[model samples]
Target: MSQKSLEEQIQQLDEQLSSSVEHQEREAKFAVEANERFARNIACFEKYYPQIATAISEYKVREDFCIHVTTTGVGNFVPKNHHAPIYGDDPISQVSAQVEYGIQHPTFSATDYTASPILEDDKRIHIRYMGALTKAFQEIQAEQKERLTVLPEHFPSAMIFGIGLGYHIDLLLEKTSFDYCFLIEPDFEVFFASLFCTDWFSIIEKVDERGGSLFFQLGADEQTFIQDLETLADDIGAFSVVRSFCYQHTPLPEIIELIQQWSSQYFRFQYGHGFFNDAITGLAHTVHLVEKNTPVLTLPKQKRVDLSTPIFIVGNGPSLDEAEEFIRENADKAIIFAAGTAIASLSKKGIDCDFHILVERPYYNYKVFGDFLPPEEYKKTNLIGLNTLYPDTTDRYKWSGVAGKGNEAGTFLLEVVSQTLNNKGIPLMPYCNPVVANTALSFAMFSGFKNIYLFGIDNGNLPTGEHHSKDSIYRNNLDDENEEGLVCMGMNGKYLPANFGGQVESNDLFMGAHFQLEKLIAHYPNRTVYNIGNGAKLKGAHPVRAEELLPLPEANRDINEQVEFLKSDFFEQFNLEEFDDTLLGVKAFNEICDHVLGLAKEPVSSVKEASDNLLRQARYVYAIRNTALHHLHHMIKGALLYYHCPMLSLLYTYTDEQFTLESYAKVNTLWQGYIIEMKEYYQHNYRTKCDHGKD
Candidate 1:
């Protein structure tokens, strides 16, 4: 036993330990744990998933522990040397304890499936569970809706959750139509069994012959599956459908759960994935904001409303029909406000709403005033909206109070003006909801309305398939047409059904607004809020039936009094120096742009160096906002976002692209040209304002 021989002996013992049952068991436990983790991720799949089994088997496990093929009439070896279950004693059982909706892989039991001697007329051999595979075929037949309707031809891509012996997959290919099919089989053993049991080669050839795409994600973790899905989704370019299938008597609950969770997350990502685009769009709107001299008001010096004043916010939901009479009878009892297009509905009914809260800036939205109301109606009601609102709509109101747009772009523009003019811009409201209802709600909160009653704020449609009250533009448009889409959860956690035979639809406009309103109301516990509607539920707001709302005391307030207060507080009085600040600010911004242009032309060796320099230039441009040049800083901020973010993205994404001096020159030239154009436009405005003299 020399030193070399002793080392060899130790190596041999190490090899034996690695091959021991304890090591194998630990590995099996790790696999089970991984599967469990995957199962947990699957529990939150989309609501659109099928509720029935959809898989069938092409191979059978006989009593002899061999895979008996029905498709190819072949027998294959399934390793059974390790008698211990690969997944554990109860693989599918753990899924029940883990998730509300999840799938667990069935245990590999040879005795469970029985082989049949009889063959179909097509010469296909028969496999069975207790002598017949009728139940499996029947399960798939019940899920014809999923294969045919849910995974329709319209969707270019299809994601299959369970590949249980490839039965459901076979039906999906032959029964339905799609450009591509993505098979996600989470269980390695199940997929392996399918390979040995079925004629997968012929299936692939058939799919290829049809000129359709087929991708397989086998035994993948959550991350791997998600990444594959994302790439597939990107390639498919939207409308990628997802469906789940489980084999009869051998369902893959874990995989089904995974698909569910994936679909939910994918939808969430799609919903809120627009930061850079928003900034770009906001920059475009900032130009419109300045051109109109839209009376961009900063916050008033003091709160206008008494915090105790009861306020009623009226929406255009169908529930408003019932509230119309109550609002009319007690018109003066509370500070009545109409949100978004609700103004049209209330005005059509001859109900005098005190304030028309208009937050949306679209030209189409302004039709609520143009198409629905007369000029007299617009004049009578006070208008409160974002400063970024269309000037055509805002100018119609005799008394208007504007708040900052509340987005990053709107805030940037307002903040720059505030810094330059030494006037604190109107209080910024959170535009978290993409809908005008939330805008009205934000303004209500801004005006110090404590006890607020929301009327017709039904975030959904009525039973008659009406989204808005009669006389509304929405109702008028859909009067003769029947279309479906827009689904939101009801108060009872089930889908709110519509009269048109589908779930009540909720677009981004309503959903975003509802969520924002919920958050806003949640902040104030003592301030009582009531939703006087039977539409979509608003959490944290007590529901008050329209009939229950009583009218009593006359309001001590008048519209003119509030109108005068708003004008006196928010109206901007101009001076000559302020005009000079605008001119000088534009000059300073151009100078910074020129400086950055010069930097871009300088030789840079690495992507990091170029990116760092560009970023530094962006920061320097941003810093100029703090100076007297701040009047034009809004444009500077916009320019910085436009240039900086894309540059950073390119830097990270295309690090391998060699930074050429010529490329820098091209980019610098582009920005320089854009800034010059903006400067000339501002110069024209400055000259015109200068000629107008003091106002």
Candidate 2:
């Protein structure tokens, strides 16, 4: 019972395990008996499980492989129907028809034989069992425990790579509080066999009825799985929700390895996309904050048509060349919404869009409008511009309607300034990226366009040295230099053509923007997004040729009349108030700064709690303004809450406590300074507005 004696006994037992000759002989006899039992068990299974046996016999079984009994009484589909030197050059003629038929270029290590066999109808049905049924159960339990250690900190959700016989999946569901499980098995026969071999249908239905769901993805390749997984992630709300993954080893271990790799890359891609989008929103807010004096125009929130109406969103991809004539001929049939530089490209083709969307704040946007046409001439076409856009472009035409990002800063700033001016952030669309194409799509979807068509919205770029259409502003910079590791899912779901110096490469930004669009559209089940871009297919968006759609009759009114209608609508309910209440505005700003700054200074014990409080405060601030900064406020609060889930580091290794301790220090400091600066900005602006009103 002494500690030292127990340690010595354990060491002695360990040595005895390696040194006992009688034990070795007994194990040798056990192996011989197990193998014999395995051979008999195969015959027994063929007799008892006649359905499976008959199915297997029906196939033209390859000559190289046949059933072989292992030391643990398990039958293996051997490469040569017997033991063969694994390192030898002899070809493996075939593998298990049921399990290995769909597996391409399968790779597995040589089998290791060790433990005794327990007979259950001679003990051959469980081919992976290495010992007695009880011993195998213990080993599986231990392995499951080890694997479960990797589960995220909360209720688990699982994705099992191979649902072998449904045993592991059933056990996993029973053990974990997983609300959903995705079963991905490429071999249809194995899945089908399991249906008959086990009570899989009942178990799946039971889980479904219990408020947990089991998604069966049978006969899917790695590519299809990736696409489906992203769609599922979006359906479930977030990529981070699926915390546990089970990979059952088979003859095709490499495929499982690739699945693991792709899953990791997919998560990283989501994180990067989210981070980049936040940065852009932050940049836009900073610009809005800096240029408070810029003329802000209110956009009209008119419901021109019902959700059943079709809206064609045009972009500046090279594919526009193919759809140009079709769009021009049928421009009046559907409301044409042109994206950023697409306006120029469409205009050059003699196609006029009903509403042109512009979101980027860069000077490059100005180049989209040809120098030949002055601001007055360009006013013939109605425009929708985000307030963050370059001043020259947003202020260019009288027909253009300027809208602010529905964000906290935009709404707050607008509220303080809009008390005197006819300015308020209008909800453009629910979108992650502020890209023109995404914005335009959001506009259509928000306006209840049930049928949406995308033209030249190439998620993938053209061949190298050819990115945009000839008339687009981006065409000038389409060189091979920017053709870095960009890739998108082509129409066939494989990677887009990557010909180095020959084909155009799509950067992650373009591909990520389109993916966000896919997620956005997934929520609206009744709405459909058809991609007419002859390049990469936008996932969730069906592809259709332009000729298949119906062309509309000529419009009763010309483009000028439409522009006039839009301009009139912009000022119909405009309420322009003079900046007369400067003191009142400053008092409200100071009160808000005090409320948030006080909370920010307090020590936070939990990152989640702190983020929740901050976000709540942000919402309260916006509500105090009593006007919407729809996109802007949401982004600001999201960024505030997302501090713990840093875009640069998404490993989830750091706990809330660790994150909060580290972040609360620097972030709170920045938050304090930012609040003070914003307060000062409001005071200065209020005084300026009051002085202007007096003048």
Q: Which candidate's lDDT is highest?
A: 1
Question: What lDDT score is found at residue 189 in candidate 1?
Answer: 56
Number of clashing pairs, model 2?
A: 17
| TM-score for each predicted model, relative to the true structure | 0.48, 0.47
Candidate 2 lDDT over 635-672, as tens digits, reads: 22332332322211212223344543453455455456
**lDDT of all predictions, in order shown?**
0.52, 0.50
Q: Measured by TM-score, how close is model 1 to the native structure?
A: 0.48
Q: Write the per-residue lDDT of candidate 1 for residues 1-695, one digit (tens) a residue.
A: 79999999999998888757554565555445434533332331111121210122223444555333222222223333433322323333332332212123311101111122323332111111111233322332343321121222222345566665554455445544444566777765566555433445556667677655676766666645665565554333222322222123123456666755664444322333222223333443444455555555555667564556677889878888878878888776677778877887787798877778875554545653575677877898777776546555667876665667643444465566666566554456654356667877776675556778888777776545566677565634453456332222332222443322445456544555665677677655566787875766666777778888878465556644654555566554322232223333446655765676666556667654665566556556556544555434444454444344333333332212343323444455555554455545543342221110111
How far in Å is the alpha carbon of 59 misplaced in model 1? 59
Model 2: residues >4 Å from true position, as ranges? 1-310, 332-334, 361-373, 387-395, 402-404, 412-428, 449-451, 462-466, 476-508, 519-528, 546-572, 579-682, 685-695
Candidate with maximal TM-score: 1
